[model samples]
Target: MNILPLIVLFPLLGALILAFNPRLPNRLAALVGVGSIGLSALVMVWLNWLFYLGDGGGFTQTLWQWVTVGDFRMGFTLYLDGLSLTMISVITGVGFLIHLFASWYMEKDLEGAPGYARFFAYMNLFVFSMLLLVLGDNLLLLYLGWEGVGLCSYLLIGYYYQSEYNAWCAFKAFIVTRIGDVFLAIGLFLLFTRFGTLDIQQLLQQAPQVWQEGDLMAEVAALMLLGGALGKSAQLPLHTWLADAMAGPTPVSALIHAATMVTAGVYLIARTHTIFELAPFTLSLVALIGLLTLLVAGFTALAQTDIKRVLAYSTMSQIGYMFLALGVQAWDVAIFHLMIHAFFKALLFLTSGSVIIACHHEQNIFKMGGLWRSLKLPYACFLIGGAALSALPLVTAGFYSKDEILWLTFDHGYSLLWLGALLGALLTSIYTFRMIFIVFHGREQIHPHAGRGIAHHLPLLALALLSTFVGGMIHPPLANVLPAGPEGQYGHLIRVLTEVLAAVVALVGVGIAAALFLGRRRLIGNLMEAKEGDRLRRFFYSGFAFDWLYERITVRPFLFIARLHRRDWVNSLVNMWPALALGLNDLLLGTQNGRLRWYAAVMTGGAVSMLFLLLLF
Candidate 1:
């Protein structure tokens, strides 16, 4: 129990080691990088044992006094309970798996140069940031950790810095997310000013007493936090950066999209559920945003050709589901889905990484085919991962977690939202299996080199097993920590029907994918070959033209204004002195030349001028 701080410190030390000793032997660097996270996961397992085996109550650990100003004081502290336990479990547990797989994925780079060290350094640092975020007892520490992950996202996403395109992708992610971060900063300030402290438990306790339900301040603060959540989770308007984040290496995509950064929003909202409870309108708004983002991202996934981008959109859609759960006050359910999601989504992304590597780094699904036989392990893992993602009944973990959200949405009387979610589930199956069938079922387009070694096989097999009914059976430690989910207002029969419908839609979607993609893909291919289909394809592929629309209304206009003001009065004012200095130097230069006679004349003229000035004075 006392060693809780060490969980964060281990990864921090690992990052520091790799960062400073950038020339460590390749295998040792891998050991430090992967082993550090492995150690943290080991600590998490022990902590889980102690906490659960004991009274199963929340624990707060104050490591040190962080700061004091007059009467205001805050500590560098961590609070753990069911919610955070579930989170750090995903972070260190799944994060460790991702790190191990990365060692195999990035092995060539490990032999190449210091990039291997830099990559692991950033990886360890990212895990540390995420741990601090989920475990922090105070809002300030959480924000510090929040911004830390943002910086890491920028570094890891722009890892291929030799390419200008990848740099812009990282830049885009940073800038878009920064907008939401500003709103979050202001929200924290609002909370601090209202309560005179930023400790999360204190704030949650004090908020309901300080503000009544539907209070304007409460609503505003909740809205601000939602702004931050949307951006970080890749929800509406701020979501454009996520798909392009695939420009980084596949492992980066897995770490960021699968279990860490994109899920932070769901964690934030769940952690601050009390504050949001006071703001009913904002709570409903959160649900609406989640619904819309899920539908939007799910549709967008259908049009993507690049394998990683497809998974990237799937990540956005899945986080949208988590947000949907949060909106419905299914707090535990949200974290439940979050943990289950971490397993299957990480599985999918890691498998996709191998697929990309197997095809000699080809990412387009249409460009590679008949892989089911060639890459047997990855193909099987993908099938299981894709099935879990699509929420196949009984056998898959996603069916358990995600189906609960749908059932709860109906129980809470959000029937319209339930239907939307059902539609989203259908979309989920179509796009997921669509990727599976296209890449693995068609005639061979490119031969794939099968992935080998324990590093690769271990994560796939482990996550695949977890993506099954076995992982779904893993109970989250959230009963004491969170409010209960919507109790069956609609009763048992309705719940059964809804589950049946959801499962039916999922299977139906898979059948549609098989019909469309398995045999030459001609029916859909003809549709896509048509002018209108191609246009729609481009529209969906462009993320419903959000980027295009943003470019015109936001980005291009801002750039145009920037260009118009590029040489504006401010710059002119700053430049005037330099221009004046340069002009004076040029005038002085005109008085002399390189010629010796010109220099002598100048010297004589200067002496005559000095004498004349003295006489005149």
Candidate 2:
């Protein structure tokens, strides 16, 4: 059965129903919300079964001709392939779990059932938009989904509209991502102008025929697309918004960080690997940005007190690894990491939600301690998720995925980039365990309630299991779908050595975190209070002051311009021409006083003057 359309439609239908009927009871709204995503997930499972049974290639289902102009036509089509199928599975499967969790999380929201319904509506809409983003056959349709998600993010991020900070965070996320969308739109225009087709498959096939490797136009187009990816993925320079996005609910954080908005860039790059390959320089730059972003965000994560902000930075850092994979031409590896990340990261966030609830919404790790006894379920889940996140050797999924990227980087002979990745891995371990120790090992500050429903723990348990075992199992199937990278020419000894070294680095980081946070707490606390340490902490905590830099460079100048034109100086200039015309009319009004004598005298003078001049000639 052609269930692709159903996958996209289910969530949208649910959203529409909820939107039109705002008075839905909490139970009904939760049912509709969870049911829609669950149905979509079911459809995706069927589609995957069909995909495996059939030829493992692309299948396009056209809904209609969406646009036409002379020789140009764009179809509202859904393309099913291994890559998109993987993405859809992640979206719907993980999305449904999140929805289920949200059902419990938002049951007692301040706005009650109406708010619950509204949250689900936006959530469903977001799912629909993301599905559209991944499944669209043409760039135009993909862009529509792109903008759709942005809108939904704005709505959902500020769901608690009463809080000015949440509203600002929503606006910040919207505006920051829009900057990337602009680049993506421009890239699409270039693609159409050069190839005359917006269909992704067609464009990929045509690009090689038309453009040679390293062609300037191809490079420019690739760069533009990279800008979009960078923004969407929360790479360096465009990453500040994500930290603020934690102002939203925990589920929103999970959705954006793990399965949806942030991962869009990785999917886009993987989808258009052909374009990136044509521009090798851009690919190299992708690697560089990934390296820098991962290191930067890792340090930032270390300084964060807020549990969500730490995860936010960690998400950015994790995506940096994916970018690094793409840079090294490990396309399959990138997707593998993406899938693994979605599992653990979502689990981590949801677990954090449970912790937050237990602690009465307290998000500071310093304020949380010795919760392992009280919040046993969440503590265990968090530990599992954190282990996966830190890529703890052969036991977790992240190790397989992340180690693949590192191996690929080394085999490709980019030792410096590989070293940077190693450092990122180390830092990731440090921060992940640091959080685990602080939040679950210290003295308990508050007594948290232990009445979370099955909806909460079930998703946590499912995701925790995935985070533990899914990595090794996914590689074989994922390999079939993605373009294969060249095998390393290195010896078995070298390969084994690299793997061992990577594991050691991760272990070392864990050791350091355990010592600092668990063993020598007073020493670390003293250092944190020291003048130099305090300054350093502030630096990393502020994301290396990128926000301050942007404010001074981008935001301040714009604000200044806005203030300068507060009275609409340009509008005044526009109005000046009309004012000048009116002033001239006023000056000349005396000469045209509607008097017949004045007209007759003027005509007589002109006639006499003409006659005299004619006689002189």
The candidate maximizing TM-score is 1
Error of 1 at 152 (Å): 0.3
lDDT of 1 at 331: 88
Best by lDDT: 1
* Candidate 2 positional error at 297, Å: 0.5
Score each candidate by Cα lDDT. 0.92, 0.89
Worst 10 residues of 2 by lDDT: 472-481
- Per-residue lDDT tens digits for candidate 2, residues 300-329, read 999999999999999999999999999988
> Where is model 1 poorest over a 10-residue stretch in terms of lDDT?
108-117
| TM-scores, all models, native as reference | 0.95, 0.92
Tens-digit lDDT track of model 1 for 1-617: 89899899999999999999988887899999999999999999999999888887889999999989999999999998988988999999999999999999998433475588889999999999999999999999999999999999999999998899999999999999999999999999999889999999889999999999999999999999999998899999799999988988888888886788899999999989999999999999999889999999999999999999999999999888888888888888889999999999999999998998889889999899899989999999999999999999999999999999998988988889988998999999999999999999878999888889999999999999999999999989888878885556877888899899999999999999889888877899899999999999988988998888878998788899989998999999999999999999999898766889988987899999999999999
How far off is residue 90 in model 2, in Å? 0.1
